[model samples]
Target: MTMSLVFRNEKFSPDRFTGCIAERYQFINCDFSGCDLTDTQFIHCQFYDRESEQGCNFTRATLKDASFKHCDLSMNNFRSVNALGIEISECRAQGIDFRGASFMNMITTKSWFCSAFITKTNLSYANLSKVVLEKCELWDNRWVGTNVVGAIFSGSDLSGGEFSSFDWHSADFTHCDLTRSITSDLDLRSTDLEGVKLDSDQVSILVERLGIRVEE
Candidate 1:
């Protein structure tokens, strides 16, 4: 039993929508500024151009199977969400906290996630292209089979992450921390590794990949 609701051009500021449950809702051009949506559940919802005028607070919200297209979600708190099968495209998600969130089967394209905290998040089988994750915390995250073409990860922490099936040929890893991160199967010939922080073992692996024999 799923109820359909629509909130078009509505504003929710300084309010509390905690513990609310809604299914198949549509939010078009709605503003959610300074609102506390903690523990609120929205299943199969679609948000189009949803604005966060003063930074909508979605801390601990459950947005399972939701889709956001061309929405402004900057400076929002999206930590601890059950975001499985989510689709976000052409959205502004800068400075959001997505740490420890579950994002399986997600697809995000042409979105901005700069300075966001996404450490320890599971993004397996996700496709993210032309996205900006610069200066974001991405340590200990699982990115197996993730498509990250044309993505920017400059000055981000990618330590202890598994990137076995990642397509990072056009992605930027400049000044990033790859300490203990797995790149055994990656072709670093065209990938940007300028000023990247790596341990001796990681450096050795990269040198070996380039067919450079080192004498010690």
Candidate 2:
């Protein structure tokens, strides 16, 4: 009955106190970290504010139009979820698994993905500005229309990945491997591509690294 009370089909308000309302609470767009929401199933939920989703299992959930700005989502499992219009800025997503997940129109700025696994994840139309994906797994992922400006993707294998319709200015691909990855028609006006693993063919178009005195 209390769980049903939380899911009142309205925005989550802490002031609407119900007494130890966690699993007691449901579908109210509320913050749920450090709460008694152990082993909860949130499907098609919408978050319009900073979340407290630490140590949560959001497995197989469909989170549409969720905004997770400035939250503490450390050690959360977002496996097999379809996230759209989600903003995960300033969150601590350490070891969070996004395997087989799809992301769209997401802005994950200043987020720390320390040792997070993001295998086969779809990041279309997402903005990852100033995010630290240190020692993260991005194997075989797609990046269509994704803006990863000022991101730290070092020692990442962006092989067989795609990038399109994103602001490539001031992006860094240093000390990373992009072999066999498709990056056609990209705007490299001021992209920092030092120590990137590319072939001679891919090196031709990215003449910005050549430091030669060519005609303007």
Candidate 3:
């Protein structure tokens, strides 16, 4: 917690950081609404303030059913967080931005629904542009070069996710499970695998990258 260190609107006592271990703490404009923070363990935490490029706002925070294990939470901001049923497991979370995180729950205003469970998290280079996160559980996450251009993640399970240099046509994996993930930079002829649930060697490595040649 160096250089213009800040911690505003602080109010915590749900066991006062349940399992404590927070290094480099700096929470500017902190609200921490409905904070439970089960098993908390934040290391090298500096919610963002790269030379006044300010972040760490956590507006409208709820963090329902919170849990962040093996945490580093690199470059955290988590803007507009409601974070329904939040659970960030095995976390390193590189470059975490989570732009305007909500995870939805309207039930009116034209109805809405969403939740989060973020598993095996690494999320390298994370920005999560246009984050939505539909039908979520998000398994075995790594998602290198993560930036989900218009992120929806429809019907998400994201099985065993690694997704190297992932783009996958920029999000909205319709009915996604993506079995044993790492679809080799998935490009199913412009990427839109409706009801996606690929298996069988990731469907022969995504139809051999369109050079199709899968025997037996």
Candidate 4:
């Protein structure tokens, strides 16, 4: 049994709502600052507001199967969040911390995630379209079979990640770091790698793919 609670235009500041389950709730113009929402479950919820610029903090929360459409969730602390199968469309989630979070099969469209921390996070099979992740920390993150069409990843650290199943031709990776990143199986003939930072061994691997002969 899940206890549902709906909040509309309400201010929930400095409140602790731990381990609560709310479903199908509509949050409009709600302010949740300095709030501890650890282990809370919010399913099928809609959080949208154009007039307000305030975002909520969900540090260590469990927001599995939630939907956020046109909401401002920027600068939120989402470290170790359980956001698997979450749907976020046209939302602002810039500078958010998603370290060690599991977002498998999540869907995101037209969202802004600039400078966000996504270290050691699992985004396997996630679908991302027209999303901006510029200058974000994406170290050791799993992106196997993830669709990232029209996504911007300029100036982001992509070191130590498995990117073999990604479509590089449709995504932008200007000036991104590929140090110790796996790309031997990726087809980079049509993909642009200008100004990208790569390790010496990784460069050799890419050069060999271009039919270049190297003598040691």
Q: Give the number of the best model, judged by lDDT.
A: 3
Q: After superposition, how far is residue 135 of candidate 1 from its true place, in Å?
A: 0.6
Candidate 1 achieves a global lDDT of 0.60
The ten-residue window of minimal lDDT in model 3 covers: 52-61
Distance (Å) between predicted and true CA of 197, model 1?
0.9
Whole-model lDDT, model 2: 0.49
Give the per-residue lDDT of model 2 (tens digit) for 1-216.
Answer: 223333322433323322322222233233332232222223323222234433455555555434343333444556655554334433344445555444433347644334434444455644465555544455555576665666667766676666666565545566777776676655445566667687655666566545543353
- Those runs of model 4 whose alpha carbons end farther than 4 Å from true positions after fitting are 1-113
Task: Please say which candidate is ahead in TM-score: 3 or 4.
Answer: 4
Which wins on lDDT, candidate 2 or candidate 3? 3
Report residue 15 deviation for candidate 3 (angstroms).
Answer: 19
Ranking of all candidate structures by their lDDT, best first: 3, 4, 1, 2
For residue 156, what is the lDDT in candidate 2? 62
For each candidate in turn, give its C-alpha RMSD to the true structure in angstroms.
12.0, 12.4, 12.6, 12.4
Q: How do the residues 1-216 of candidate 1 rate in per-residue lDDT, one tens digit apiece?
A: 242777766776544454566556666655554345544554455453334444444544555444454444444455555554444434444444455444433247644334344555455655455556676667876677665666677888899887876676768889999898887566667777888898888777778889987666
- Predicted candidate 3 versus true structure: per-residue lDDT over 1-216, tens digit per residue: 252345655665445565555655766535454455544555545554456544444445556656666655666667667777678887777877888788788899988988888898888888989989998998988888888899898988989988887788977899889898876678888888888888898888778888989999
Q: lDDT of model 3 at residue 79?
A: 67
2 against 4, candidate with superior TM-score? 4
In model 4, the Cα lDDT at residue 196 comes to 88
